[model samples]
Target: MPPLNYFVVESPDPVGKDAYERIAADVLQDLDLIKVIDRLHIYVDPKIPLFVAAGLLRHMPRAIRVSDFANVNPGEKEIVLDISEEAYLAPLLRILWARFGKENVDQPDRFTVVLPAGVIGQKEIEQLVVADPSETLYKDVIYALQYIAPEGFKVRRQYIREGKFYYVASEDTLPGDIVERVVAPLFEKMGVTL
Candidate 1:
């Protein structure tokens, strides 16, 4: 297991119990994992900044290890992929394009692509790029993840300062305990008894 990292998210409106469940599902869908530790925590302050979310994200799972999001099939002389989602498709395509020539790559749809054989496992295919040098592919994926939540949610400020993270959504402030109470029951409803 890798070291845990914290995340802070803010919304422009009061996030109710239903909203919390949606957010949790989105997180799970984005980062599919077998089991996340019980240490996970979420804080929702619906006072000034409308809504705020802060918590410790334990053992962040790898994108490729998640599910069939990126299917790699060995073709006669190439690797065919049937990407059903665009959330992480850009980065995957960019990395593949860099390895195989532009001519060797083919995009049949917004969510599908084909790559030459030499690039299948010959090079390092990064499942996740924390920071992208090109800026386009990386930033797009990050933006997409942020938008996965409901519409009312507006990201005010996200900071990973020091070892702790703080995210302020709107312009209001609420006690951290309140946020915890709001999310607790939702977790239980999601079958996370803890």
Candidate 2:
């Protein structure tokens, strides 16, 4: 199992606690999020029909840009891009075409791209963001939480803010003070503030 600085699943029933531990572990692993989660605490109170998950995330990598995998250089008549990794070729091309019309951008080969002179500056091209891992990571975390929650526990609240993430769900309308009552205490157990 990948290391999570802290992990716990609490329930009034010991059997239910063990089952939730297994389910949460399997779901986090399946979504490839075990390493990204620094600490986690899940509290399931079936008697009250409530579930809460509080967690802190590790520092995530920054966005992917053209310069990360390609080289931009000046050409006699145009700007040339020498791509080193093919994985980003498709997305790189899409961004270029949208920013500078397709007429101004041309790809002559699998790993080469040409842009008309004065169309865009080399520095600007290098900094154009192609993908942001944090954006996708937030979405993935929400999906994983939803999967871990008990079935029919549909009413939900989720947050990804300031290096922290939280999820709360219930079959009935949640109490107005869930954050102050249940969520805050759970995060306190992990040495984090919600």
RMSD of each: 10.3, 1.6
RMSD of 2: 1.6
CA shift of 29, model 1, Å: 17
For model 1, the local distance difference test gives 0.46
The count of residue-pair clashes in candidate 2 stands at 0
Per-residue CA lDDT of model 2 for 129-187, tens digit only, reads 98888998999998999999998999998999878999999999998998898899888
- Candidate 1 residue pairs that clash: 44-179, 48-171, 48-172, 48-173, 49-170, 49-171, 49-172
Off by over 4 Å in 2: none
TM-score of 2: 0.92
Candidate 1 ranges with C-alpha deviation above 4 Å: 1-68, 122-163, 166-194
lDDT of 1 by residue, 57-111 (tens): 2333443521336566657787677776567676666765676767888998786
Pick the TM-score winner: 2
Once model 2 is optimally superposed onto the true structure by TM-score, how far is the C-alpha of residue 152 displaced, in angstroms? 0.8
Clashing pairs in 2: none
